[model samples]
Target chain A: MPRFNAIFFKLALNSLKSRQGSVILTLLAIIVSVYVLIGVEQIRMQTKQNFNSTIAGTDLIVGARTGDINLLLYAVFHMGAATQNISWKTYQELTTLSSVEWAVPISLGDSHQGYRVTATTPDYFTHYHYAELQPLQFAAGQPFEDVYDVVLGSEVAHKLGYQLGDKLTLSHGLGATSFSVHKDKPFRISGLLQATGTPVDKSLYISLSAMEAIHIGWNNGANSNAAHSVIDTQSLTPKSVTAVMLGLKQKTAIFRFQRVVNEYRDEALLAILPGVTLAKLWQITSVMEQSLRLIAVLILISSLLGLVAMLLASIRERQHEIAVMRVMGASPWFIFSLIEIEVVIVTFVGYVFGLLGVAMSFELAKNIGLEHFSIHLSSNIFSIDQLIYLALILIAAMIAGLIPAVMAYKQALGVRLD
Target chain B: MKTSILIQNLKFSYSPQSPLILDIPSWHVEQGERLFLQGPSGCGKSSLLNLISGILPLTQGYLGVLGAQLDTLSGRQRDHFRAQRIGYVFQRFNLIPYLSALDNIRLACIFTDQQQDSKQVEDKACSLLISLGIEQSHWHKASHQLSVGQQQRVAIARAMIHQPQLLIVDEPTSSLDHQSRDAFMQLLLRQVESTPLTLLFVSHDHTLSSYFSRSQSMNEINDA
Candidate 1:
C-alpha cells in the first residue's frame, strides 16, 4: 500500500471505531439474510437428492396409463391410490421380454397398522434397489418364503415395537376403521429390513401368495372368508398387481422396452423413465423454489440497502474528516477508496458469520435430518453454488460502498479545510 | 531572485456568475522575510492565504511559489507541490480528532518526501514539542483530549515538522486568551527565526503584528 493510503486506512478504521454500533447492526442484518439464503438453498438441493435417491437402480416403473408424475407418486412413493391395476398376465409377460432382467410386482391397497402393506416376491429382496443401487439388507431373519410370513421395514418395526416372530394382522384396505381383517391367517414377522431412508422404510412387505390366500373368498371386495376354514394355496393366484419395477439387462434397451410397455395390446399401461420424470417434477415445483430464492435475494438487497443507508447518513458528518485528509495533500481517490474499504470489512465479517452459521447448523442437524427425512446434506463449506453466492455478495457490497465513496470524494473535493 | 511567493494581477471567484472574492494587482514575499498581514473580518485574509498555498484554483493570475508557476500546474500537481514545500496552519488548528498529537504531526510528513527514517522524524517532532511547551506525557494523547492552547501548539509543531521553506499561519490564535496568544506568537517567531524561512502570518488582531519585521493591512494591498 502507498504511504498515504496507509494513513487513510488507519483514519477510516478510527472513523468506524467512533460509530461502531450502527456498523454492527448493519452487519447483523447481512448475516441473518445470508444465513437464510444458505439454509433454503441447502435444504432444497438435498431434498431433491433424497427424492432422486429413492428409486435410483430401477430402470422403469410400470403402471396403468396415467401421468408420469402421478405414476411416480402412487407407485414409487405410496402417496396416492392407483387409478387402475395391470393384470398378472401382463406382469408375467413383461418378465419374459428379452430386455428385462427382473420385474418385482408390488400389490398395494392394504395397510398393516398405518404402514402400507406391499405384497411382493422373493426376487424383490435380491433385485429391488434404492439409492446407489443398494440391495435391501436384513436386520434380522430373511425374505418371506411362506404364505403367511411377513417382513417389516426398520421404521415400521421400530415404531410398532415388533421383533422377529411377532404376529400382526392385515386390514382389507387403507381405511382407518376397516370392517374386514385377515384373521384366518395372521402373518408372523419373518424379517426386518435395515433402514434405507426411502419410502421402503415406511412400508411392510409380504409374499404374493399371502395376498392371494387372504382374499381367497372375497366376492367383489366384500370379505366372505368366514365360511371357509382353510384355502388351497395351489389354486390361489393374484388377479392384479398395482405396479411392476423393471430392470433392464442392458441400459440402452430402456427406450425400446418403455415404448413396448406403453403400447402393449393386452393392457393399457405407461412406462415412466424415473430420472426424466423426476426432472419434470422438479420443474413443476420450481416456481415455489424460485419464490424462496426471490425472498432470499430480497433480504440480501434490504440488508445491503441498510449498509448504504448507514454510510450515506454518516457522510455529512464525515465531510470535515475528508477535508482534513485533503488538506494533508491526500487525493480524492484515497478518500473514496477508504470509505469503500470500511464497507468491505463489514461485509466480509458478515460473510464469515453466514458461513459459520450454516456450518454449525449442519453439524447440529446432520444426524437428525438423516434419521427423519433421509436428507444427507453436505457439510462442506464451499460448493460452486456457495462460491457464486459469495461473489454476488461481494459485488453488492462494492455497489453499496460505491455510493458513499463517491459522495465522500465529492464532499472532500468541494469543502474547505479552514 | 527566487522569492518564496510571487503574485501579479490575480483574481478569483467561486464560479463564473459570482463576483470576484480576490483580485490583487501585485504582491511578493521575499525569502527569509517575516511579514504580518492584518485585516478585519471578511476582508479575504483566509482567501489570500489559500491562494498563496495553491489550495484554490487560479483562474486569472500570474502566481508563483518557490519559482514554480501556480496556474501552469494541475490540481494534483499543486497538491504534490504543497505537500513538498508548504506548511499551513488553519484558523481552527485543524488536527484530526482521532489521532494522537504525535500522529497528527506525523501526518504532515506521511504524504511528503521527508519520510525516510521514522525515528529521525520522531526525534525532531519530540524536540519541537518540548520547545513549544508540550510535555512528553501529552504527546501521545489524542488531540480531542487536549486543551485549545495545547492543540494549537501541536498544530504549529505539525506545520513545522517537515521543515517547509514557506510557512502560512492563518489566524490560529482566534480562540486563545491574551497571555497564551502572546506566548504562542513568541514561540512561533522564535522557531521561524531559528531558520531561514519566509513567514506569512495573517490575522485581524493588529496588536500581534508588533513582533514581525513589517506589517500591512488588507486595504493597502488588496485591489478588490
Candidate 2:
C-alpha cells in the first residue's frame, strides 16, 4: 500500500516539477502570506509579554495623582516626564504602615547620556523583582552606598563602554543631549546590574541623597549658581520623589494598602496595580493588534485562493493527463486526491520556508529592537498558538484546494465517458 | 472458446436528451484474438470500445468483458476490474509528459494492490522497455523528451507491462509514420504472442488492419 501511494506521490512531484513557473509563483505567494501571518502574531505576543514582564512582586505603584497608565509609563518604563512629585514624607509615612512590608522611593529627572537616572535606596535591590520574581543580581560591584557612587544598568554600561570606577556626570534635564551638565560633582560607576531583559536594563541607579546633593543650588531646572555650596553630601536629603514601589507581606492586603495610599491625608497620591494597569494599556492598544491580525489572515486567505486558482487553471491543461490516468484505471477519487496532494505539498513547503524566514527576521529584529527601542523580544520562537495557526493554514489550504479537486474529479469522469 | 467481450442491445449517448450514438445489437470477440475495428472520425467506434471497457455507463444492454457482466458492476467495481485486468493505450500523448519512460510503464500497476515485489516489478518494467527498443539511457528521461516513434514504443511497453487480460489500443499508430507504425505493430503483436491477451485495436486508418487476425468496419457493427 505504501508503494502504491508512492507512485501517486511521485507523479504529483513530477507534475509539479514540469510546471515550475506557476508552482513557484504560488509557493511565493503562500510563503509571503505565512511569513506575514506568523510575523505579526509573534510581535503581538512578544510585545504583550515584554510589557507584562517588566515588573513583578511589587504590589502597588504609588505616584502623585496621575492616570494609571501614565504612572506606570513614567515610574517603571521611564517613558514620559512626571508632572508632579510626591513629597518624601509621604513615602516615609507609607513605609510605616502595617500593611506595607517594604517601600522603595524612586526619584526621576536626571539623565546620563540618554539613559534615565533612577534615584532609589539600597532596599530597591532587595525588594524589586521582574519576570517571575527574579531578583536583581549585580554583575559587578555592590548597590549604590555612597552619595557620589552610581550603579549602571547592563545596557548603559555596555553601550557607553563604562567600566567600574568610570566617572560620568549627570545632566540636569531628561533629554539625551542636555547642555546643563553638573560638572563639579561627577559620580563613579560603582556597580553594574546584570541584564533582566526589562526596562531595568536601561536605567542608571543612584541614591536619593545623590539626587538631592546634585540639585543643591539648582533653582529652576538649570545649572547651579556661583555661590552654591561645594559638594554637601552629608546634609543632603531628598524633599520629593517621583514614585514609590511597595511590596506587601500579605497578598490580600494589596487592595487595602492601595486604598490607604490613594486616600492619604497628607498628599494626593494614586496607587495602581501594575498588572491591572498593564492590562488596561493593552486593551487601549488592542485595536491595532486586532487590525494587524485581520490583515494577516486576509493575506493568507487570498494566497490560498490563489493556490486554488492556480490548480483550477492547470486542470484544463491537464485534461489529457487525467484522461490517460483514467484509461490506466484510476478512479475519479484519484484525480480528486491528486490535486489535493499537490496543494498540501505546496503549502507544507511554503510553511517550512516561512518559518525559516520568521526565525531569520526575528534574529535581525531582536538586536535592532533592543538597541534602539529597548524592547526585548524573546527568543522562544515557536509556541502553541503558532502551531495552531499552522494547523489552521493547512486546513484552509486543504479546503481551498477542494474547489479545484472537485472540478478535476468531474472532468476526469467526463473524460472517461466522452 | 472463452469470450473476451460480448455486447447485445448495447446503446450509448452523451445525454438522455441526445440521440443514441452507438446502437450495436450483437457483437462478440474471443479470447486471444486480435480484432481490428476500423472507422472514420465521429463514427462512434471509440464510443463502442468505451462501452465494452466499462468506461461509459451502460444504460440499455447486456455487456460483458473478460467473462464479467460490466453492466451489473458498480462504477467503482468496474474501475477496480479495469485496473487489474485491462490495459489501454491512447493515440497521442499516451505517456504522462513529465514521468520517465520506465515510470510511465510502472504507472499501469499503481492502482492494483497485488502483493508483487517492487524489485520484480521494476525488473519487468526495465526488460519491457528494453524489448520495446527504448534505450536504457532514455528509460529515465521524461516521456515528453523522447521522439514520437520512441514515445509510441514506450506507450506500448506501458500498456503491456501489467500483463492485462484485455489490451485496448485506440488509434495508437495514428501519429506514427508507416515504418514506425509497422514497428509499433510488430512489437505489440510479439508481446501478446504467448499470452491469452485479447487485442482490440481501433483506428480510422485501414492499412493497419492486416496485422490483426479479424477485421470489422464501424458500419458492420455500430448502427447509430
Candidate 3:
C-alpha cells in the first residue's frame, strides 16, 4: 500500500502539472464558492453580534403587549412601528417595582428624515449603554435639558451634517415622508454623542415631555375641527409616552419584574428582558440564516461536482496513461488514490484561497461598512463556525471526488494488455 | 524447466456483436525461451499477448502463468499476478510524456514492497540505456524529446527494470528504421539471453523471425 501510495502521489502530481490550466480553473471555481460561503457567514455573525450589543447594559424594555421580536425591533433597533403606547400612569407604576432600579420612559413614532426621533428624560444620556457596556459619551455638547433642546446621535449628526446650536424641525411620523414638521417649534442641537456603531447612532434624542408637548396642540386641534395644525412649542401640554427602558436593581429579578409589569391592570403593557427579546429576534431570523447556509452548501456541492466532472472528463484522454501505469505494476487502487489525492490537493488549495478571500472582504467591509452602517466586521479567523465550514468543504470534496476515483478504479480494472 | 505461460483453447471476442478474434487451441512458452510470433494487424496478436499476460480473461479455456491459474483468479488477483511476474513493452508511444527515462523505469519498482536502492536503480537504468545505445544525455530528457528509436530503448529498459520472469514485447521494432530495428532486436535478444526471463515478441514482419529460436504464424495456430 505504501509503495502504491508513492506511485499515486507521483502520478497525481505529474498529472496535475501536465493539466495545470484545468486544475487551476477547477480550483478557482471552488475558491469562489468557498469565498461566498465564508463571506456570508462573517456578515451574519457580525450583524448578530452588533444587534446583541446595541443596548447591552439595559436590563428590561417596557412596551405595549407584543411579541418579543417586535419589542426588540422597536426598542433596540428603532425599526418597524410600535403597536401600542404605554400610559403615563403605567410608566410611573412600573418604576415602583421592587426590582426596578431606574426607569427611563421613551416616546417614538416621530422621525427627522429617516432617523428615528426618541423622546426620553435626562436619564437616557446618563444611563444608556452600547457596545462593550460603555455609557454614551458626548462628542461636543451636553444632554437635552430644555424642552426645545435636541441631542443627536453620531450618525444622525454626520449624515444630516448638523452641528451644535443648529436648529432642526421634527416630523410627525416615523418615515422619511412625513409632511407635517414642527416648523414653528424648531429645536437646537444641544449635543452630539460619539459613534457607537449601534442603532443609537441613528437616533434624535429629546425629552419625553417634548414629544408630548408637540402632540398636545394636535389633540386640541382635533376637537376644534381643524384637519391638522402645527402647534407652537410653548402652547402645548405634555401627556403620554411610547415606551420605557428599565434598568434592574438586581439582574436575578429580571423575570420576576417582567411578570409584575405584564400584570399591570392600569394599561395593557409588557416588560421584556432585552437579551431574551434579542435572542427571540435572532431565532426568528435564524430561518433566513439557515436558508443562506443551505444555499452556500449547495454552491459548494455544485463546485465539487464540477471538480468531479472535470476529472471524469479528463479520464478518457488519460486512459493510455492509466494503461501504461497498470502495465508497470500499479494496482487499480493506486490509480483511484491518484485521482483522490489530486482532488484533496485542489480542495486544500481552494480552502486557503477561500480564507484569504474572506479576510480581504472583511478588511474592505470594515473600512466602508463600519463607517456607514456602524457594523464592525470582526478580524478573528479561528471562529468555530468558520472551522466547521472548512471541515464541511473538505468532507464534501472527499465525497465529490469519490465518483471520479471509482471511475478511475473501474477503468484500471478493465484495462487490457492487448 | 517450468513453463512461464501456458494457454489451452483460449477464446476472446472484442465485443458481443463481433465474432471471436482469438481462438487458440493451445500454446506454451518455456522459461528462458525467446519465441517470435508473427501475425498481421487485426489478427488478435495483441489479444493473444494480453491473454497470456493475464490482462484479458480467457472465455473458453484455461491459462496458467508462473504456476497461477489465470482463469481461477479474480480480476484483482490477476492484476497482482501480472504486476509481480509479467512485464510488457508496447510498439510505440511507450513512455509517459511527462516523466524522464529514469522515472519511467522507477515506476515499475513502485509496485513491489521490496526495498531497492535508488542509486542502484539509477546505475542499472544508466547501464541499460547505455547497452541499448541511448546516450547518457538523452536519458534525462522527457520521452517526447527523444527520437522514436530512443523511446523504444527506454521502454525496453522500463519493462526489464524489475527483471520480471516473463517479458511481452508488442511490435516494439515496428516504428524503428531497418538499421535501428536490427540493432534493437540484437540488444533485446542479448538481454533475454543474459536473464532467465521468457521473451514473447509479437510482430507481422517475418524477416526478423530467423533470429529467434522458434517462430510461428497466427494462421498456423488459429487457422483463421
| Native-referenced TM-scores of chain A, all candidate models | 0.92, 0.92, 0.87
lDDT of each: 0.83, 0.87, 0.82
Candidate 2 docking category? medium
Candidates sorted on DockQ, descending = 2, 3, 1
For candidate 3, lDDT tens digit of each residue in A86-185? 8777788778867789999888888899899998889998788877888999999999878889999988998889999999999888769777776666
Which numbered prediction scores highest in TM-score against the true structure?
2
Tens digits of per-residue lDDT for model 3 on B48-131? 877777677777787888788888887667777777788789987788777778778877777755567877877888888888
Listed models, DockQ each: 0.46, 0.53, 0.48
Considering chain A alone, what is the TM-score of candidate 3? 0.87
> Clash pairs of candidate 2?
none
TM-score of chain B of each: 0.96, 0.97, 0.93
Q: List the residue pairs that clash in candidate 1.
A: none
Q: After superposition, how far is residue A371 of candidate 1 from its true place, in Å?
A: 4.9
Ranking by lDDT: 2, 1, 3
True contacts kept of each: 0.37, 0.52, 0.59
After TM-score superposition, what is the CA distance of residue A370 in candidate 3 from its true location, in Å? 2.6
Best by DockQ: 2
